[model samples]
Target: MQVSPIGTFFGDAVYKYEAPRQGRLFAGHPGRIELNAGQNFEMALRDLDGFERIWVIFQFHENVGWRPTTRPPVPPKGKDRVGTFASRSPYRPNPIGLSCVRLLKIDGLTLYVDEADLLNGTPVLDIKPYIPMADAFPDAKAGWVEEQEGDLWTVLADAPFDAQNRWIAERSDFDLESFARVQLSRGNFSKGVFDSTRRRLTVDESAHTGVLAYRTFRIHFTYDDTARVVCLQRVSSGYTAEELQEGTEDKYGDKQLHRDFITLPDFRR
Candidate 1:
């Protein structure tokens, strides 16, 4: 009964909260799996590149323990918690996870990937090419998920927000635009859409403005309640001037990014 990782995943999701509920939703966020050398894993990876997608069996290394019942990201109607086996909670019995990630390319032992929901440095057990004939089941009934509403809010970004997001992404691994899309796109708006409590977000109906916290950064956006549309306006530093001051504590090691962020042409220093 022995198990070991064939490789390690390097991705932008530094924290658990940064990862999307599903990998497919995190499309455009790229990552790589650096397989161990001298094991002929490169040969193992041969012929895998042609497949557009692959099933990655990985380990949830950060989860502490398993919970019998875990709260889902978007809970079903009238159900606060579901059986651990039912939901894709990281706190599983064995901390094992499976994600179908897009295969960009393979360079030697490094497999370029995208749409990965696993956190940074996650251990990958194995990979298998996805077969559309064997996996396609569009007609399949999704149990609790089917009970939820199907409508999704359209997420847009203004010229300014787009500029700021691009700037930050160039300096860091995170992608604020995609993160916002995944979090704000779907949910029951009547019951506080996008898991406001867990995601640390607030909305001002009067002003049509909403602010979403993404670790050391803040996303400011405006929404049209009637249209179910969210338009990102700008990006800001969550840290105060004092916090970003010289010799201050850098809890997440990203204060420097914020320091330079405030200098954006439109934002005040």
Candidate 2:
């Protein structure tokens, strides 16, 4: 079989199958793909910032050959492996990869991105801007991929699937107001005490759907017309810490507990 060359990528892009199967993986461990050496790197990245997200078409420079069937990160039902075309595994006959990466920032020809599953220095063939009206599907069905959708944490909590091998640096500077707004929208709130003069809120959202089935966490937030402060609380009845500890267990039931929430300091800093 003869395959026409689409285009060459610059430096080998970062490969991160470690990324969640979907774009929501941004809040998780994310890496980058530096493109600047394959073929026409600068020409392809021109005016890329105009798009909030971009569809990156690239080659699986690492994939050696074809495979009839491959194992997807999450196998459906009783199926462990499916036809190559049925899944997005890089080990395919063509070995082509398509990723819609969130355009974080752009500098000249280099595009900094998030929610990218690519590896460091992976080759990029073509780039296309993403339009929400066309790219987002409010009623779209993912077929087998749909079964894999759930709480981003639960899905990504468990090695390759859980980022067990990767190091997650706790980002201490996440904007509290922004986090408070998000939590408030999810309807996780209850009135409480504040810095002595003002009242605060403890937001809690408990539902069996989406992800995090045994949900029991609260966000300590206070939002005014100006700013907001947000913190975390264990809300799983008598089981918050226990469940979290269980969720972080390794694939082989190791003792190392995966710290779920970033433990907040006792007194407000």
> Which one wins on lDDT?
1
TM per candidate: 0.91, 0.48
Runs off by more than 4 Å, candidate 2 = 1-20, 28-46, 148-269
- Write model 1 residue lDDT over 1-269, tens digit each, in one string: 78899999998777776778887864777899999988988778878879999999999998798999977777788888889888888888898999999999999999999998888899999999999999989999989988764367899999988888888878887688988887777664445646665567887767878888888788898877678888988888889998999799888898888887887677643
Q: Pairing residues by index, what is the TM-score of model 1? A: 0.91
Task: Give the clashing residue pairs of candidate 1, or none.
Answer: none
Question: Which ten-residue region of model 1 has the weakest summed lDDT?
Answer: 188-197
Best by TM-score: 1
Q: For each candidate, how many residue pairs have backbone atoms clashing (under 3 Å)? A: 0, 21
- Least accurate stretch of 10 residues (summed lDDT) in model 2? 190-199
The Cα error of candidate 2 at residue 215, in Å, is 31
Model 2 per-residue lDDT tens digits across residues 1-269:
65434333332222232223444444432444455455576776777778888888877777698889976544565666778888887777777789887777776555667666565546666678999988888897767866541122211122221221122213222222222222232221222211111113322334222211111212232222112222222121213346446445444332232243334232211
